[model samples]
Target: MAESKIPIYGAIGANVAIAVTKFIVAGITGSSAMLSEGIHSAVDTFNGVLLLVGLHLSKRPATAEHPFGHGKELYFWSLIVAVLIFGLGGGVSFYEGIQHIRQPEPMRDPTWNYVVLAAAALFEGTSFLIALRQFRGQARGVPFWEALDRSKDPTTYTVLAEDSAALAGLAVAALGIYFSHALNMPMLDGVASVVIGVLLAGVAVLLIAQSRGLLIGEGVRPETAKAIRAVVMEQPSVEGVGRVLSMYVGPDEVLVVVDVDFKDDTPTGDAADAIAAIEKQVRARFPMIRRIFVEASDAPGGDASAARPGAAS
Candidate 1:
């Protein structure tokens, strides 16, 4: 959790500074793209605040009402962030672009636009590098796309995606400003704003999907499930391992319920011992597994059908 905050803090600081500069420049230059960029930075600043709030809320202790703790608070807030990005960031930018197109404004000297953009790029780039480094450390050498697909935490990736989009939007704004000034076609500025909106929308949609999955209780990776099963099978008193049900209750916390078949002749006391051993081994192997429930069955073949309806043999 401490690590997650590093990138978010960096992003918030950078976006706040950039947003103010962008709004000032947009006011001075009357460039549609610059205005849109200002909105984008402002939206990003707000999103960063929301993410921080979510992170803090998610640290609350578990209560009877929420046995799994408040981890999903982060997911819920992340989803809200995505929605805001779509509505406020993307929707507003696109609308502003269309309005500018319908009533084009005369182009002004773009010197300030270029200056602000260059400075924004520098700050945004620095923030992006910080986020990328954090994400890479978390990925632990996993390929980029694959790691992103498997990531349970939203903060690092969300910042990464936002920064990446921001960089791209800056490029488009630069081009639009250049072309509008060079060709004396102010409508081109509006086109650039529209493109930035579309880009933001695309990124928001992806974030929404990812956050939705986590909120709905996504499970561990297949390889992790397989490894857990292997650990149970290694126990001498165990006959078989049944369904290895698991869910990520928090970024670094997992709840697992495994169906274990102890040898039919094993006494209840020995079975209990084996269950304890199983829990210890699993926790030792995977510290992220915070809570584990072993459903032990003494039946031959370790069948758990009686204990869990629809449980596989």
Candidate 2:
């Protein structure tokens, strides 16, 4: 989690610089596309700060109010970033575009706009590469898209999406400024602003949808669950593995509950020892699983009912 935060810090620095330049150019040139890009960068800067706060909050130890720690705080903030992207960034861009369409203004110093945009694109591309590298590490041997879909971390994906959109917006803005000047149709610049807003809204929707699942208690990856089952079955004192339930409570924290049918003739003392051994082995095998519950029964079909709530680790 700490290592994953570098991208967010990088983004904050890059976006703050880019946004200041963008706003200055937008004011000087009166380019709708440039104004839209400024809004995008400003919102991204704020979102980076929010991610940092969320990361810090999520790392807080479990408290009386939050027995599982503040892990979901990150998800909550991620959701807020999505809403801000759609509301403040996308909505304002769309409104500005429509106003510009109704009342076009002759741009001043178009060359400066080009220079600033080029620089902004360079910065944004670097940030995108950083996020892409981390994402690729998580992707491993699997398909990139599939890995992203299954990723448990929200900060990396948000930064990646923002930077990718930033680069695309720069391209669109450049084209809009160029064509609007050459063809003497300033409405195209307004159209470009509208496109940027639509793009942001779409990205926001994607983030919101993905984060919603995670906030609502998404389970561990398929492989993690399978490995857990394997671990439980490998125990000598266990006759059969019943059910294994798992969920992610934090970025790197997992909660696992397992039910096992022990050997029928095992004594009470031996069963207690077996439970202790299983817990130790499971924790050693999967260090991320901080909270674990193991239930023993006489029959494989014995209803473990549901896991009893225990103190979070």
Candidate 3:
């Protein structure tokens, strides 16, 4: 969580520099593919700024008007990022590609496009590596895809996906420029621009799906819920476990409800002691779990008893 800002900051700086350089080179060469690369970099730069703003807004302290704090602000901005990519990056490139295909303008001084593409690749590659490292760290022992699915922090994986797409777009732009000159078919450059746009569109779709799921309140992973059950059941005072629910209130912050059956003969003092102990143990075991609701009932492991008011055994 502490390392979340690095990718956005790095990408912002790198994309800003690369965007300017690519625009200059595109102007010099008059390559449609080169111009598309410039536009891609510019869009990425803007997205980085949006992400940082989201991070800041998400950090706001909880108020009466917004008791949950502004954690979901990140999700809202991430969705915006997706829409922007689809509109500005993909839509514009698609329009430009088709226009260029019809016009078929020959590229002049194409060597400069190659130079700018190489530089952009280097910067994008570095940002991608940083994002990949953070994502791997978050995965822990789980499979990468599973970790991505369970992860509450969208910022890390979003950066990784965006940088990955950026790198791919840069490579496509270079190839398009090269093949257009080599084969003497200016239309190939236009095709390359369309391909870059397609790549961005795909990435946008992925980000949108992930952000939407988060906003809709996807619960804890099966493994995590299972672990929570084990922790509650292991306590001596617990007779049996019932329904256990987990919800993420923020990245690295979870609100949990664990229903347990206590021995009939257990005194109120004993139940209180057990509840306190369970809360402490669970919090220590999973730092992400910030709040817990443990209820006791006469019956064990039934939906009827799960919803019934809990009484002291």
Scored by lDDT, the top model is: 1
Runs off by more than 4 Å, candidate 1: 299-313
Q: Of the candidates numbered 1 and 3, which has the greater TM-score value?
A: 1
lDDT at residue 180 of model 3 (Cα atoms) = 95
RMSD for each model, in Å, please? 3.7, 3.1, 3.9
**Per-residue C-alpha lDDT of model 3 across residues 107-185, encoded as one tens digit per residue:** 8768888888888889999998888788788788888887877777878888888888888988899889989999999
Q: Please give, for residues 136-171, the per-residue lDDT of candidate 2 as tens digits.
A: 987778798888887778889999989988998899
- Model 1: per-residue lDDT, tens digit, 78-122? 999999999999999999999988888988899999999999999
Model 1: clashing residue pairs? none
Residue ranges of candidate 2 with Cα displaced over 4 Å: 137-143, 299-313
Ranking the candidates on lDDT from highest down gives: 1, 2, 3
Clashing pairs in 3: none
Tell me the whole-model lDDT of each prediction, alpha carbons only: 0.89, 0.85, 0.82
TM-score of each: 0.93, 0.88, 0.90
TM-score of 2: 0.88
Clashing pairs in 2: none
Q: Which of the two, 1 or 2, has more TM-score?
A: 1
